[model samples]
Target: MDRKEQKSIIEGLLFVSGDEGIYPEQIAKVLEIEGNEVINILEEMQKECEGAHRGLQIVQYAKVYRFATKKEHASYYQKLIDIPTAASLSQAALETLAIVAYRQPITRTEMEEIRGVKTDKALQTLVSHLLIKEMGRAEGPGRPILYGTTKEFLDTFGLKTLDDLPALSEENEQMNEADLFFGSLQEISK
Candidate 1:
């Protein structure tokens, strides 16, 4: 097929796939094109979304990709949408969540050690929010319940996996930015 036709075909496939990102190899096999060509097309499409000409952006996380909105339109988009924005968690919960997210499969005592505070209330709040869960039991004395972030956390953050979270150095800022960016894109898609 001609390049123009190929582009159209690729766009159609991407749209059909929607949030379930297609791998380059899969696109290549389906379209009878080189994997490199598929990569190029995907990159070009992503650039179009991120470029000044388009209102959307593309991001890849854990090998999965999604079309998101540009950060510049955050405020106006917020006014245009009816998204849930009033949930507030206590500082203790936030602290506990951070610990659990980074140090998953950790025991309650380990969490308390990191925060230097009792985690009963924080753990309860996190569990209620469905962000943190008791993954299982530790393999040691007393066999305490291991804590970890849930799949809900991944969906809420628009992540394909835990690896999508960047390195721990700028975790808070990176996480906040990702939430704002993906959250806004979700609103726009709706």
Candidate 2:
């Protein structure tokens, strides 16, 4: 396949495959090309993602070639996404994030059960914003990654640690007061 066509196929397969880190063979099958050809195209793509030309990184250490924001360029994404600050969460994201914070090492399926909605978007947003991360795989059938808040989560909220999060109760306040919410911009926002 042509380079343009191969690049298109790679992006589609990677995005659709989610964080699962799809294999080159899987991408090759989708593109109807020899697996070696897929590998070659991926090599070219990886080079393009390197150094000064990069806003994207083609990562592979986790056993898949998924596109990701280059670490140095991360400060620009809040602008590109048109959010007022570094990142903003939907209410659903906040709710699920709360659950994950209080009950960490939690699975997506378990979070879904608590929130009663498919958490794909919220989880994606949370992960993209670096508020939560994949702790590790569960010991269940799917072996899904457990989710938990990160050090950035603590810093963003001006907390010394996760234990600094405010107490919760049986009451559900519409506008809860907690360390979780902060001013729209902070230390790295400039």
Candidate 3:
């Protein structure tokens, strides 16, 4: 494809790669371009992201490229996170949090599998809100991050412990898992 198209594809690939990042060689393979070309394009994209108007920047860590927030705007980001709101939890965030609560130390992939959709954004939201945290890395290839509910999560839900969460019955298994999880939280919200 053309240079512009290549850059756009690279951006999407990097975004989809999430926190794992992507290697230049992988980008090259996917775009059917040379590694040197990928590096050049990445460098250009990195520069563009560094512009004052851009809130994101491309970061290279150990040869893996990924998008990250501009450190210069840390205060603004902190402010955004620190602001308290009466907004209820999003459906996706609630579902993801429920999965994490019921299934502590679960991998993102497993959560996505259970939800039948990607959970990256939901996971990020939960993490930013301090409702969930990265417990550790799971054992196996790639060593994906394992997530679990935080103390704040218990406090927010007014639960003394995870055991205090409503039990999921086998009959409920026939219903959508998200609905089951959401229903329990709705009661607490009232």
Q: Rate the local accuracy (lDDT) of all candidates.
A: 0.76, 0.77, 0.90
Candidates ranked, most accurate by lDDT first:
3, 2, 1
Tens-place lDDT per residue, model 3, 1-190, is: 7889999999999999999999999999999989999999999999888789998899999999999998889999999899998766788888888889888889999999888999999998999999999999999999999999999998988889988887889888667666776687788778
Window of ten residues with lowest summed lDDT in model 3: 173-182
Q: Quick one: best lDDT, which candidate?
A: 3
Query: What local lDDT score does residue 16 receive in model 3, on the 0 to 100 scale?
Result: 99
- Please list the residue runs of candidate 1 whose C-alpha ends up more than 4 Å from where it truly belongs after superposition: 1-85, 169-190
lDDT of 2: 0.77
- Residue 57 of model 2: what lDDT? 73
Q: Rank the candidate models, highest TM-score first.
A: 3, 2, 1
Put down candidate 2 lDDT per residue, 47-91, tens digits, no spaces: 877979767777786557787778887778767777657457888
Candidate 1 local lDDT, 1-190, one digit each (tens):
8877877787777667788866778779989989888778878878767667777666666766556667898897988786765767887777677678768889999988877779998899889889988889989789999999999987876768887764545545545433443454467457
**Model 2 bad stretches (over 4 Å):** 1-86, 169-190
